[model samples]
Target: MNKIKPGDIVVITHNTLPRLGVVLKVHKREDPTKDIARVHLAKHNKAYNFLISDMEKIIDKNT
Candidate 1:
């Protein structure tokens, strides 16, 4: 991925459920194996991380 940042609209599809989310923050993770992706969702108060493989491009509002 290029320089993805906070507020960028991204879709994170849940493996088990039909759900997509908007991206809130994109940052490097402490662990080398993981890149951090924060999402803004009303269903959950907390932000969730999805691996690069799990992320989909729906829109780029904040790009």
Candidate 2:
């Protein structure tokens, strides 16, 4: 899996409905392999932290 970078649009699936957000930061935890993604959900006007594995990069449907 490719590492998610800041500024990339991502989809968070932890809710009943998947949310779209822009990644603000990628943090490496003490575990090294356990990374976290900081995302800004514009619709909700909130920022949240989620496991990197729980988010997916949004691909353009036009491509």
Report the number of the highest-TM-score candidate: 2
True-vs-predicted CA distance for residue 33, candidate 1, Å:
5.7
**lDDT per residue as tens, model 1, 1-63:** 554566566566657663466777676778744776777665686677776556766666653
lDDT string for model 2 (1-63, tens) is 766888888899877788899899999988855799889998899999988878888853333
Every model's TM-score: 0.60, 0.79
- Model 2: which residue pairs collide? none
* Residue 1 shift from truth in candidate 1, angstroms: 5.2
Give the Å shift of residue 6 in candidate 2.
0.5
Residue ranges of candidate 1 with Cα displaced over 4 Å: 1-3, 29-33
Q: Looking at candidate 1, what is the lDDT of residue 31?
A: 78
lDDT values of the candidates?
Answer: 0.65, 0.84
RMSD in Å for all candidates: 2.9, 3.2
lDDT of 1: 0.65
